[model samples]
Target: MNSSLFAVIMMLAVLIPSGMQAQAPATYYNSAYGKSGKALKTELHEIIKSGYVTKSYDFLYTIYEESDTRPDGKLWDMYSTCTWTHGQKKCGNYSTVCDCYNREHSIPQSWFNERSPMVSDAHHIYPTDGRVNGQRGNDPFGECANGTTLTNGLGRSGSSTFPGYSGRVFEPVDEYKGDFARTYFYFVTRYEDLMSTFSTSSTSFSGNAYPSLNSWSIALFLKWHRQDPVSEKEIVRNNAVYKHQKNRNAFIDHPILAEHIWGTLQGSAWDVTGVETPAELLARVNYNANERSMMVAADLGELSYEVVNISGVRLLSGTLLGGDAVSMGSLKPGVYFFRANADTLKAVKKFIVQ
Candidate 1:
């Protein structure tokens, strides 16, 4: 974003307060506007699924060096308090928690038949203590009452403490609950198209695109997402993952996006501002094939927008007002995103055209 566009954006939408700050460029969230509930979830699904780079399961070890490294160069294993050097200890075999580290599928591979993209996706695969990973044993994440504590004494595995289910469950420490919750959110949304085909044996997922989580899991994850909040560790990891994976954890980038689909913001338009809206005002782009032009329209009062390709390369940018149709007829045929923002159209550097 240039200085002039930033000035236009600030004048269009009200700035959201601290908790739900919007982070991406003006064009990143354009197609998701005026959508809520399932529609919002679908928009998010499309956004996160774009440009995904599929690495082999073995490559997760490489990903952790950047995504989960602690300041002292130790693996940030949430499953145990044990300290570990990045590549020094592989999970050869472990009788104790600190003996070795391995890839722990936060969403266990069995539930999805150990398939391709899902199996290799680094977003849900975490480097964890082998012993604690064994303790989890494919249980759903939840509060456990009188649960068996791990060797490090932070995580627990036991019968349910939460309502609606009494099955065995695993619970991590409070500090990382939000991180795990948001990871689950990204997993379900990104794979939503295939969700209906996934096995629902775990009882956490309903296997549906919208409200994909089971009743109990929905309550549990929402509670976790609200309590833990996004942290600096998550922000750093999000960037690192996108650098390799080509997509983002939208829930981490815009925590309020979760509310629009599953919590408080339901039934409301998905706006970057998160302001209360009285009606369903729509904004969209339609390419006029006859004239070889891109047509953008919005009822968002005065606005600022940028046309960018999937790689974040800017093609065109300017301001628009009212319900008028603005055309870019000279533009060639190609897929482009029409992003709208208030005054926060800062530097969109991920993709820059020379």
Candidate 2:
């Protein structure tokens, strides 16, 4: 933990309220309200693409310094456990895992003919280990069986064991499955207009704007998105990328948007208006000091919860089951908070985490 990064985190801890929700600036989704299904996706695509600021491929390196910085100040590389210093070590040659870092396009560049705009879109371009990025080699994400593990034991490459697809795939660390899943959602929606014209394509594309994702991808991504809810790491990174890109990942801001467009709530009109956020649901919940545990309010239905310190860094995250006590275990004395998706009930709590 370098002094500067530690200081920045501590300062953020104090400045960001424990219960504050990470969402858009009030009306960013205004145009999509009350729309559902394909109409909602089209409106959101218009909103994001219009707000986007164009930059170059090389400029992505500059953006990585901020977007991928870990809490410990090292570059946050998902593929390998390399403690990288931003702007210092870049991919030139690599014989092993920790050789250097490079940009990983979650969606392969070849699928879109390595063209501009999509080629440099920061939303899916990640800072990752060079060697593992090579290993992943544009393989679509999926669960694996009898796989060759990547640099870290956290990821793997092999035949897909995920229900729908049986092709070769690359599975990232469990911690980042949802991150990548939502990133896919953003890519499909933000670029819905350009689908047909792409130079090449993957099996994941449905060849139309309505349900841009293939059936297999639709099921796989929905599962990943639900199991791995958004984290403080994602929220911070989302804000950082928006600083340079001028557009935000709507899935990160409002995860439920995915449901309206493709999942369980597909036909329901998307209405963010007049919605009471999780902060407003605090009255229905309470902390159990003796149990050292938590859960979403019974009325909110099941959800995923994030526990964090006064500073917004995440401490723990898991399924927010039926109001049954979920053990939080030990913690240093300080004000901590518990929160869930703003799209789902928005149940949050401010309590001394211990």
Candidate 3:
């Protein structure tokens, strides 16, 4: 589906929700702000001091696996087309975790010098297949794919185009055009400032420098964004990745959230309410009266958060006192929202009962 239509679908899903907002949960805030390199290091130290699990490489691996979730043994998995089972042939037919697929950077890293940052930046890294990556080549994504006459060596055609420069361009499969579109949005947001230092065979951004990306690439991505909207799976993965990375992508975060944060941070606009955030940041419930609430406590332990009642209301919110027994039997319970916050980090959870 096109970006617009995909957005509409997401909107409808959000509107028809069982009480969750159409927007992202409060956890996105935790994923973005309130951390510096030194602060992160300090926080990691504190976690270690508290005997929390803190592995440097494990963090990256956790995010990678959560983002990819490939049961088929594909290094990175993509959404299934036919069924909902992970790696199932023609999957994505079910609403389960199977719909999300592993996408790739259309501009392969190997084309560049395989520099330290670009190669390692997980923001641009994708879960596309090795076969497709080889087919994409170093071509800039562009309009040549519109024509039928062109042919790529891999039986694909029309991927090459006038990149507004001497080099070539490539096109993505129709299904993933939107994925690349958002990925490009993410790429620009993550590295637009350093782009001038980036080595390119052609000067794609020499002129018409408003949003500042290769015109061919930008145009194609914009078209894809407008045509094939983001999927629920993509949005979920984007947030999950953000949770792991502690940075927000312009394309991945809800467009509004990105706009508000970017405008305020970039000084492009004066957003007064930027300081105001969801109540989840303050406190939440960590235990329940009825069941053991194993998963509920697990979220709190991992995220260091608290819980609240439904309706965005707060209940018991604080740091984990680490007592095995947490009292909750006194409160009336239909549904509840448990949350936790550490500076800019926040996590929300839902629970239900009799």
Candidate 4:
């Protein structure tokens, strides 16, 4: 079908669930004028034009905070201050702000011949580094080659050891991998037409030989969606960007947004039998979390859970029980996992310190 119709169908699919065809909760209002595809396309152009006056490469550096030698001041350095100025040392492995980053293009501008709206799109561009961007290259993302050796773990860059798929892929550090994966998902879905012209042998592309995403790319994206899932940071940034730019993407709207899109459009669900939350039988087993002694519970039917930090290291897991409180008194004063699982439902709740 057409892009507009396709988006509508997908949205509908997301609102309604499978196995049971109950009406969707009226929580989300379609703000896209009932025209998601073309309207978004037009909106993208407008957003770019509006930001044309204020956007500068320098602004990018500021957003992530890289060291600046330029008289104009450094964007990266400023961003670093925002993210990690509290500690003298960088929160990440890098020793300095400059060492830690580059102004990364979330959507490689090359796909649209480096067009304006797509080129400097703030929604997709991020402050990454050269090494990580190089490893990521233009290849579509997927499971790395079995022997893929890591070049820069901090940048999340690596070469796949998998035959046929052995290519450079910028694997994101655990913290933002899910966000990056979701960005790619949003990009392709947004620009389905432009996707065909781009290369697609690696995990970076859709892997579909037809200039569109092949099944492999789709499957890989689905996997990435799970492994390096969304974070609170992304949500905060997403809202900030939307407010600042007056443009928003569905992927940035919610973690489960993709599930809705894919389910509605493709009628498929993300598989997670081996990858989902842990068993509920482990409940009542004390686990340390977030420097606070807390209780954990699970609802087997819902796959919902909570995580209380007993120590710094987060004891995170999924698919346990929901509403079933587990004790945290015996555990140490650090991060802990109080996972809850009930079928396909899943969440990672973070608790604070005393």
Q: Give me the candidate number with maximum lDDT.
A: 2
Better of 2 and 4 by lDDT: 2
Per-residue lDDT over 218-258 for candidate 1, one digit per residue giving the tens place of the 0 to 100 score: 78898988755555466667766776777778877777778
| Candidate 3 lDDT tens digits, 1-354 | 465754554443333222212344454334334433323223322321232122342244445555554222233443123222333332223233333333344446644466544555455565543343444456566555453321221224343554444344555555456666666556544544455555555423422212446546555565666444443345445555555454544454433232322222333332223323322222233334346352322222323444456444556644553233344554573655554443333334344433
Error of 3 at 138 (Å): 1.8
What candidate 2 gets wrong by more than 4 Å, as runs, is: 1-23, 199-202, 273-354
| Runs of candidate 1 exceeding 4 Å displacement | 1-26, 274-354
What value of lDDT does candidate 3 attain over all alpha carbons? 0.43
Q: How high is the CA lDDT of each candidate model?
A: 0.72, 0.75, 0.43, 0.43
Q: Write the per-residue lDDT of candidate 2 for residues 1-354, one digit (tens) a residue.
A: 565755676554433333233445777889999998999999999998886887899998888776777654578887877788999879889888888888999988887778779999988999888888888886888888688875453588889998868888898876688899989999889899888765334456777776888888899898888866665556666776787787888887777788999998988998764334333345444566567766445665556667877545798877754465677776675667676654464434556543
Report the Cα lDDT for candidate 4.
0.43
Residue 15, candidate 2: alpha-carbon lDDT: 35
- Reference-based TM-score, model 1: 0.70
lDDT of 4 at 203: 31
Model 2 vs. true fold: TM: 0.78
